[model samples]
Target: MKNCTLDLLGIKDSRLQFDPKYKNKVTTDDFYNHRKARFIHLLQSYPCFCPVCGKKMKRNGFKTVEMVGLPSGGLTNIFSIRKQKYLCPSSAACPKTITKLAEVQDVKANARISQAVKYQAVSKLGQNISQKYIATDFCISSMTVMRFAQGVSTYLKPNQHYLPQNIAFDDFKSGNFSQSGMSIIVMDIATHRTLDIVRSRQNTYLRSYFLQYDRQARWAVQTVTVDLYSPYRAFIHDVFPNALIIADRFHVITQAYRALNQVRIQAMKQAGHGSHNSRALKHYWKLLTKDSAHLDFKHYHKSRNFRNLQLCEQDIVERLLAMSADLRLAYNYYQTLLQAVHQGNPALLEELTQSAAGLPDPVKKTNRTLRKHRQEIKNSFETTFSNGPIEGTNNKIKTIKKTAYGFRNFENFRLRILVELKNSYVSLNFHSA
Candidate 1:
């Protein structure tokens, strides 16, 4: 029974002695609205000699302390321990007296919480829940829960000595965390682990931040995948001299996707409001934006937009395209770009971008963007890397923010994200320190 009680409480200190009549007693905790298990024990280990004078010490008295322990069998465990106190041997020549209390390794000095409980609390912080929820679980205040998390975060700091060979960069809405309201998220492409989250994505801030790493670390990065954010390209080139900046394929495709949609909207407007053509354009927007190759030509159905005309997806799209000459031109460009990207054909994309004349203004702008980052876009097609992992990490950050309703303190927010996402940094026994 004694061994079981020690195991349940995670008490490894051999000096601590359990009471003869000690038993796991469960009682109702009205304040916390839960059941608690109370155990009584005594810590009577005495110091053999005083550190100050190297003389024998004498026992003074026992100091009673109440410490919260890990929950067992759905009940909160509390330890009432009597710690032995000692006084150093007094001498006329030494003229100094020291008093000390025997301490347990599992619990910190003057703290009412055991290290085991703190470890559990820190582990719970990694989950997608608010600190208040963790507080309720441990029957402690929310402030205490935050302190436990902060303590673990001290050891979870990112290792700035090394950087990954392939990395991806992106930003998310920081929501009052930074002055710019946006923060950069760096991720390792190989491991798909979030490397770190910088407080700002501004050019100067990014340059200074990456410069903290040694020249070798910066030069080791080979490829950096990013969206169409103009500042990011400049920042990458300046900091990582050898890294090839790969434009995100999704963003590149989105540029053409958006332009094509704009052309369709214009076509709808030219068709006039409340007209059959305009209504058809509005209704079949998905078909217009969908990849032309995926349209089902075999599946035939009656269409309500064309007097119940017998038509398939291909037939409907072809008929819609015939409504406006500008729509046909934009659709052809978008479909060509989409195919080029999907097929990983950079030559076709280059050809289309080079000769995009007579295209609408929106498409022409997209063509210019493609021309500007032509090499990066080609690198994107050649490499298997993308910003997909960082995008997923951003989604997790959003979930963390939403679960907490929002974070007023950016450090706490960042720590929570790192604790949750960067598992390599957090350890199971971090709180033992």
Candidate 2:
């Protein structure tokens, strides 16, 4: 016979994958409820001495302790432990005077679920799973899931004392109303880890909040990437004098394209709102936003509408630009600026900004704004830094919030983000807790 063979019957229990620790002492008994399989584990203990007294004691009786458990046999689970109880013949023999129960395994006080169940639930929480689902899966209450999430967050939480040399800053909507909070997150650009979060993006509050960090940590920062927010730019200047501010290319293009869209709208109106040119302009709006390099100049229109001109994306853009000289100038400037940033031509940017007198008011305004932070705009060419990572992090935060139905407290929301971020990349372990 082989030394080891596959236990096909043992392979039948899926709960084993959930890490059942007390295998030697716990026995599994399962039944069906409403045609659904349910698991019950009977927990008992061997005779042992009290840790405090270190004196062997006879097992006098058993007390039933029920705990939430992971799913087993493709169904729900329940654990009923016959927890051991020992009687000290002489009260003086027990060193700890108050306790009557002898410990067998570690479990949280006044908690129905075992630590194992809590752990597995917390691990799922980090994946942005709904608490209701976790509660049902682990046979626990939603509140217990919340408590576990909070603990797991605290465990994997980063050190707040340090901010890395390269950093990115961006704000996300915490609540919808004007009276609601505006939350901004600071991230370490090198490690791409979130540093900390603040409840408000207001200048006064942000300045005061960042000022509290260690001076050396502030000085350690070498570069900061920011969106077009002037206050954020100003805040970085004052707080991190040694760091160069790099305006993210994505934000610059985003703002420029926003202005370009306005120009396009004006072109449509000039073409007559209901006219063929204007309708084509609206239908081919996506064509304008696309990169010219990707445009198929020979491609023909397939749809049969008002005009079957069979114009490719490039041809459509050219026709759209021909609608108005002002629109042409704005589109040219938008494309040129994108190229300048991309090709690292600071001189081109300077020329375009300085000669903005001929552009539409919107384009001129955008150029002026870019020129105001001229040095930061130029700095984008020096390094690759973007709030791109911030988008991914924000998506995770949004997922966590949505899954939880929504967090009423900002601190809990913040904690959930912190832990959930870590949870995605790191496996949950007892040592981590």
Candidate 3:
């Protein structure tokens, strides 16, 4: 910025200059708008050529229009352009006679907002700025802001419908609460981007949507990784019969941990809330859920256990383990499942599945559920794919919903998702790879 200059009245004045890139774009200089709403400038176009004859053209009169311009330093600008109109007269060789208005590269024809301003408006959405605020900042109407966002949505839409080899399916709540109370989000597992968001996730809609894909697109899918949700599995079976259904490792392991935590909670309650076992369970729950192989507890000098009065760092876990048989069994089962998954041991998984009969009642419920999908669970170890990336995409969807405070139009909400996939944290090019 230039140093502030003080007039005799003690008001500071400053001068502004255009950047070198934009200097050539403007022929006449800039001035304050008459309404004092923005800084207005006059822009000129290059030499005109006759469209009909492809010969040297004559400049007739000017066609002027107002346009929103790019902003800088918190100051909004407007452009008033006088486009050159060339006359192509009728002749035997070239009979057509017409007047064509010169087009500006930065602004679309008949558009009130410049392309730069429109793009900036859409970019501001990623920063969690509301559309109303962007409109005020750009000196445009809120409707124009929506129009800009819609235009951006159109640009970010996928160009083709080629089937993804590996994909994941998930759902999230959207603006329209009445239609289905939630929306389905389909993701390409490799890119970790949302491919589409539909208003419903029911079987009827899902079948119709996937059926729209050409036969080649459907057949190209080789694997579909999902949680224990039954609908997606059934849909894959019906539509893409050859694809292997792999249950996500994270979801399966999460179920095991949840079941073990239930057993721990039961033990704590039986010991009483204020009792030794209950207190240890409450404070050291993290230690119980953590895998034994990953535990890194260390002993500090002279730190005595509350129960046994002996030096120990894992006193809580030790005390709880000795007090409850069901809790210990559940913990053992949880660890065994995790180990089997990490090692890709189907034999150990089969052994664990058979041993579910002797498990704690709470854990047995989860174990039974896992066994029901044994084949899918086993497929997880054979493939490197999972819903981990899709889960991350869901996290982004939550942020988008929170940023906009919820969307009412599902169409606009869908577009916003496309914007995020193309421009947000990952910056992935779905098919560009």
As a TM-score, model 2 comes out at: 0.83
Which stretches of model 2 miss by more than 4 angstroms? 1-45, 48-55, 91-99, 156-158, 176-180, 300-307, 422-433
- TM-score order of candidates, top first: 1, 2, 3
For residues 1-433, could you state the per-residue lDDT of candidate 2 as single tens digits? 1112112212222222222344643344543334343444444455567566767766677686665555666665555556656654556756454335533244566666667776777777667677787777766677877787677554444444677889888888888421446788788777776777677888877888888877888888899998888877677778888998888888888878988899889888888868877887788888787767778877677533335656667777887787789988988888888788788899988987887878898998898888887888899888878889988888877777778888777766776676567622222342353
| Tens digits of per-residue lDDT for model 1, 89-181 | 568635777888888887777888888878788788878879988887887888888887887665666666788999888999998767789
lDDT of each: 0.82, 0.71, 0.70
Q: What is candidate 2's CA lDDT for residue 386?
A: 86
For candidate 1, give the lDDT: 0.82
Best by TM-score: 1
- State the RMSD for candidate 2: 5.4
Candidate 3 per-residue C-alpha lDDT over 116-226 given as tens digits, one digit per residue, 9 for 90 to 100: 677677777666566677777777776777777775444455434577888778776665543667677777777665667766877778888888887888888888887
The count of residue-pair clashes in candidate 2 stands at 0
Give the runs in model 1 whose Cα sits over 4 Å from its true position. 20-49, 52-56, 92-95, 154-156, 422-433
**Residue 256 shift from truth in candidate 2, angstroms:** 1.5
